[model samples]
Target: MFIKNKRVTLLSYWTSRYLLTLMIGLLIISFISALWIRHTTLENRLEMIEFMAEEMVNRITDVSIPGIPPDERVPNFAEDRFRIRDMNPSMYIINTDGEVISSNLPLEQREQSTFSELINEKEEIRKFTSAKNNKDYYAVKKKIEIDDELVGWVLMVESKDKLTMVKQEYGQLAILIVGLALLGWWAIYFLSRRLAHPIKQVAEAAKQVQSGNYEINLSDHIKEKEVYELVSSFKQMAGRLEQLEKTRTELLAGVTHELKTPVTSISGLLQAVNDGIVTGQEAEEFIRMALVETSKMKTMVGDLLAFNSFAVDAVPVKISQLDIDNFMKDFLAQWYAIQEQTDIVIKIHLLHKEVMISVDLIRLQQIMTNLLTNAEQAISGTGEITISLSEKEQYVSVIVKDSGSGIPPEEQELIFERFFRGENKKYGIRGLGLGLPLSKMMAQSIKGNLHLVESTEKGTSFEVLLRKEG
Candidate 1:
């Protein structure tokens, strides 16, 4: 059974999560704010009703005659005079017997006994639900006193629904909160897409590379530093891989042709001798030629194996402290003795003082021999090969320069790439192009480095850097 995994895109994932969180957070805040506003609005409405009730009490008390009986004392005043500020609560003057004496209530409502039933003598203010109208109302009461004697009470009643007008405002607040949340989500949507765009391009480019297509294009106008770096690095890597792939294809064909040549030569020479086509001395010469071919083949194979082992970190080095001046003298002498071309002149310039450095002799010899051999090969017949040593800071530099036609300007940068042979050497050279790369690897294994300082038409110079003894 095959099961496919679910995947979420960056755009959808980020936007959806942000929207959900924003909506939930805004809803919570709006709910709490709405409740607070509703409570405050109701409290403020009650305070207004209480103030209006007190004012009405004063008006009723001022109009009362001193000797008049409470039932007969109908304080005469204009109905508009009792209205205070914006509050127009229903005002009533009732006796201690709970009978409605004077009121601003509608005639139809006063005909009903609901007002007397809603009054609470023990409380200054009270809330009641009217059975007749099926609505909530608030009744605020204040005592009317004539000469400090409580004669009757003044009541101010207002509908609870009227005081709760914040419901409409709550709707507006909810819309505002949602609008801000949507605006924030819009901003986040673009931001997430902007961030994910470059990364998405890189991912698609990677897929193309995986399919063996190195040619890819990505936007270069990115303003963000880190994203720009990612795109730039990937483009450079793809170009390098393309170059490496081409080199690898060329190397494969070259290796096959090179190995086949020596094998064919050895087979032909041995077959000629074995067929009795040449006798004694001539046959011996044929065998010698075969041995030479075999030796060349053996050397090529050894170099290949050595390079592979070093690449995998299997080759080990033996480090020892050696005097640089003496080591170079012995090394050049032995190299000179093996040269077939006597016209190639060798010169050495050593520092005045002896410099002791820690190095692996065998590895160092391999690096120098490769450089010297390359320099010797570069010179046609007569040319100078200068081996000079210098000390700077805590490092020693060995510079090997040759008076031969230098490496072509175009091929200089790729000298140390594996299997990358220069244009001239690709045709003239007979072995695998691992000399410079292997030499560099060996130099690094011994805690040193080999690099081409400069390679011009005049001459080419290579430098080897080694750490000096403490």
Candidate 2:
């Protein structure tokens, strides 16, 4: 066999066509979720910073130090008094007039324009980045009221840089997406291979059949129902092909032997008479034997021709209502005379006084004659043959039973097949095995059926069903 060029594999094709696209979609979703988390985290951190700054202001104004004078309160309050004051190391305190009150950050980091903007804003807390240093900051400004009169405002500032936190979240999400993609790759490969296995097996089996090898063993270890059915159908076809090959070989051998024997015998008989080896009464007897052989050959040829006609649907049947009881009486009389020397007793049992059925007269007689002949040949000695006629609702049945040795169990089904002669050679059976097949075809051409009703060591019975007259 010539090999073709290789193409893309099923696993890679499915992954590229579907799995990769799905992984990319999931990655996009993960990125968007990470961004949302970063935004929400930043907002929460800013709120926490503002709350801490307000607590510090309340402590400073109340002067929690025991004996600190008013002038020295701003500078003399111990830094150790406030625990939350150290939450933001870059903290700042400014008054309402935009003047710095106290601060941990240097003056260079503070922008006066930003402080002015914060004071004019209606909101209590606002966020902005310093223009000079590019550092992000959140500023919270609160008004200090003493005796129902507004005093100075307290402005608190904290630096807001969340690059490290955002980067950490993004890294975690990237790792998760990567892990899921790896798992998806394995899943896609397994499913794709599973789906493609049956097709591959079928292709391989076809190749073997093309190469004249019909012996194929296919596995039933498949889960998919459709694939299993396909495999089963292929196996059945292969089995049928194998049987056909065997049947053809048998047919060729049988044809060669059947034609050769009769022609050889006739040729020898004629040559002996021509050479004057026998004379008078002996020559006449030899001629008679030759004529009988010739007749047998002619009958075989006629059977073949009839079978060929029926195979192509050329056997025309003219159907009409037949008087079945009267027909069988005449038919059995003819067969009785034909088999008189064989000591076969033929009898008829008519259950109905009169039964009319729709059938082709000539074809019906031919089928019955063939069956009777087979029964006659099967009898090795004295035997009884019974032909029973019965009627059903819409059909009539003719059953032929014989007291001869019954057909073997294994050979019963094949008996009706063309060119199938069972092991009955001991009785000197001379036929091309077309009798039953031709009879069956003739029966079917007139819309009827022939079947073996039962067969045992004692006897064998065959039944024929035909449509009855309306």
Candidate 3:
């Protein structure tokens, strides 16, 4: 009944080490208990016999007369004159010559050798089994004396049937102990199987997963809540793996399509030049167009390489502390000079003019450059790009906000994923979509995070959080 699923054999469960050890321990305890009971029973019976024997000696001496032979001096015990207390033993009187003078034994047993052997015996107590009746007995002897003269002996003989009855009762108790032990063994066997079955199910599920089969259904196997949670986690992991495989397939297709465009264009241009389709100024213009396409392809290839390197930590970070206000002022000046843009209004806001924080200067600059590039592309005409810096308790924040066409709500989260392109590609000749993802990776390597803080139809703001120096 314990093996409800019938996954393992009952014999094997019972033969497990846990149940075997418990049964053996119980058996040993029962045996020790039986031995102790037998010992205590014998001690109590002997003590009772010793105390009864001592009392009989005192009674006999008080009844006897002085200066007379033990035979005639003592009145016949069978008569009412001299009496001894009878406490379930056969009491007897014997003279100095080993002949019975008086006895409580049956008349036919008076002349028996079993009775004759006990007369005038100096021993305190002896055990004997009678030859005629074939029954066990305890015999105790006390001397009968008058005024310090030894007259005769008084003997007390008791049957051992009571002791035998005590042993039989103990035997019943041993049987009960054994019965209870067997019951306990069964209970343990079932309990152990209950505990082991859940673990076995988990092991089987793991084997399936190792073989690339993640469709494990543990609904039928109910166990503890924790085990259920483990099964649930495995299911979730399998689903994620499936999604990743789909994404990988899509990435391969996209790469093939993107690479083919520039290569096809290059092949067409060279073939046109060889055919002499045009001459003079037209030829020069075609050569310049081809160079532009080649440059675009080169930039895409470079982005791919950078993304791959950042993914595996192949690029190194050089950490340094810099003044927040001064560092951003210099960075913005260099960026604006490089762009040579006169229409964009670049504003700067600083919570602290001189907040020093630790960062990889090169990596942080690259990340901010990527964000600014994305913002400039989003703007169609004259717009404001605001760079705000603030210090928090544990981190320093750098937010870049642009007054341009914002990202769509649905595409905000996926924009940071590798090779993910948003809906707004209006700037012409879109990038390979690795810039934001690679920037995010670089941020994470420095124990920081880069995220789109907010985006709406009005504008979008991106924030970079860096750990503040303690």
lDDT of each: 0.83, 0.77, 0.73
Q: Which pairs clash (backbone N, Cα, C closer than 3 Å) in model 2? A: none
For residues 97-144, write the lDDT of model 3, one tens digit per residue: 666776766667654466557653556788889776788887877776
* Residues 346-377, model 1: lDDT tens digits: 89999867889989999999999999989977
List, residue by residue over 175-278, the lDDT tens digit for candidate 2: 88888887878788888889778878888998998787999988888889998999998988887677767776886687778878899999999999999999
Model 3 clash tally? 0
Clashes of each: 0, 0, 0
Best by TM-score: 1
lDDT of 2: 0.77
Show model 1 residue runs off by greater than 4 Å.
1-6, 24-165, 221-225, 392-394
The residue ranges of model 2 lying beyond 4 angstroms of the native Cα positions read 1-192, 220-240, 391-393
What is the full ranking by lDDT, best candidate first? 1, 2, 3
Winner on lDDT between 1 and 2 is 1
Candidate 3 colliding pairs: none
In candidate 3, how many Å is residue 16 off?
Answer: 3.0
